[model samples]
Target: MKHDIVIVGGGVPGLTLALALAQSTSLSVAVLEARDCVRLFKRDARVSAITQASKRIFKKLGVWSAIHAQAIQSFTRIECWDEAGNEIDFHCETLAMSALGYIVENQAIQFVLQEALQSYCTAQIFYSTKLIALHEKEDAIMLSTDTGQVFHAKLVVAADGAMSFVRERAQIILDKKDYNEEAIVATITTTAMHEQIARQCFLKTGPVALLPLSDSYRTSLVWTLPTAEAKQYMDLKPDDFCKALTCVFSKRFSEVVVVEGRQSFRLCKQQAQQCVKPRIALLGDALHTVHPLAGQGMNMGLLDAAALFEIIHTAIAHHRDFGSHAVLRRYARWRKADNFPMSVGIDWIKQLFAANTPVISLVRVSGLQILNRFPTIKNYFARYAVGERNGLPKLAQ
Candidate 1:
């Protein structure tokens, strides 16, 4: 197979990349996936509490209808508290046009994205086609698949994920380490219905969040705890887990005596030594994978796709090839600016709450109090989560 571009990876970022890039060059683009097909892609139940900025990108891609149909709208409220159940912060009433953020199940999102990508454009999806080896030349890169077929493309975009095959073969270095915490994620039915409020309680060991879902009677829980503690909790029966949850959540969640679809994953922080190199580039988790504390993992990837799409066009208009070093550098520059801050922010939050010292606790809890009091400050941060800059890229705004 031959294409102007070969995108490796078919997850959220890769599909979004296909949609974003199709708008740029008239080049033939092919997305290669290892999956045999896009069936009920049972992805992680973890949902993205996405910002409005990210929603705008979907709107531009004509993906909003699918998401809206499948997603729950979160407006009006977000609450945070300390380990002692002291309210740290709250967001409400007015913070731009909507509330703080939205939460969408990852699997449901993948299903919708697959549908939109298929219907929105003419790009072909190559399922179950895994990249086995790569050889690059001045004009093109040759990709050999597991099935013996070979592919040729002028540039390869890797959104393959944290353990990216292309990124490794290309020899891009990364800095990574585990956060030493495991997050137990699940959906639970609450005794008192959620009135559209998102709440988080940060413990000395970690943080537990209850994000609003579609049914006012149910909520999503993401509990980050010490790895050992997480393992013990996961080993508990459903009933026991629900009882334990009540102890942790208390009255805020009302009754929480039931939960479904329980799952757990270890937390990690990984960043690339560099985001781009010559004809190859990384996007999404391939570039940087942060902790799930903020639920912005996919949003950051969407931003990367948006920026790269625009940069490719600008490069083309200037008569520069899309794979040129300068062109790739432009993508890197835009991504690095945001990626670094986000990595730091997520890590800082992890460290802040992970501490047990009383003084640290006072500072952290008091800070949340101050943040809760200021809607102006909250709105500004909220805008960042949604990818809304006053000067957001056309695809994102």
Candidate 2:
């Protein structure tokens, strides 16, 4: 089989890219996914905080409307505080925006993207198929699947995951840091309504985020803790876990009840030394992974898809080889510049907050208070968080 572009994952980023290419250009795109379609649709329980930039990209792809019609929670304000009583608030009104971002379940986004992809005749999804080998050619790339099938493409995308087989085969080095921390994710119902506000509280161990969901009384929880402590929390019965969560959260929500099963994942900050090699470009988790402190992981990946699409579109307009190293390097450079700082910054923030020493705690408290006093700085951060920035792709703009 032959295709203009072969994307080696069926996740949100990969599907988004395929749909964008099929909608905007004549490229024949194929997506190779290792899981069944049903499994892919129901895999992720976590919700993603979609930034304004990502929403715009989805709009351009004609899927945002469907996603909006589905269950999505929009939060206009984000309130963050520490155990020391220092608090910082970010409001969308201050920035003249309707909402900072929308919280959508990961599966919902995937379902919408997959459904949209079906309308494009140029895009094909191959589930239960995995890439087993890749070979770079002068004019094309050859890929072999676990099913003993062979395919060729002018370009291949490594959107598999953080542990990407394509990236490994390409010999891309990764700089990784294990924070030795784990994040506990669950859905909880609180006695108090969320009021369309996202709340996060920093504890001595780590930060806890209460993301507003569609239900006023339900919120998604992402609590970071040491690995061992996370295990203890995960092992607790539902009622006991809710009690502990209420206490740790300082009873701000009155009372909390775990409404869904809890899940935990290790927290790590990792970035590929390079995001491209010849005809192969990395996207999403294949390129970088950051701490979930700010919920920017999916946002970053979506922007990556947008940026790569723009670069390829421009290359096609100019009659340049979209898969050429020169063209792919533009994407690599663009995303690295944007992703590197975020990865480092989130890691720094995690480390800074994890330290509960007297001096560090005082510094944290003072920093939040001082930053809160300056609307200019806060607005700048809020803008960045909502994906308002210079050099954005045409789709996102």
lDDT winner among the candidates? 2
Q: Per model, how many backbone clashes are there?
A: 2, 0
TM-score of each: 0.94, 0.97
- Model 2: ten consecutive residues of lowest lDDT: 36-45
For candidate 1, give the lDDT: 0.80
**Model 1 worst lDDT window (10 residues):** 88-97
lDDT of the candidates, in the order given:
0.80, 0.88
* Model 1 misplacement above 4 A: 40-44, 120-122, 373-375
lDDT of 1 by residue, 149-227 (tens): 9999888999899999999999889888988889999989888878888888877778888888888888889998889
What does candidate 2 score on TM? Answer: 0.97
Q: Please name the candidate that would achieve the greatest TM-score relative to the true structure.
A: 2
Which residue pairs collide in model 2, if any? Answer: none
> Which lDDT value does model 2 have at 240?
93
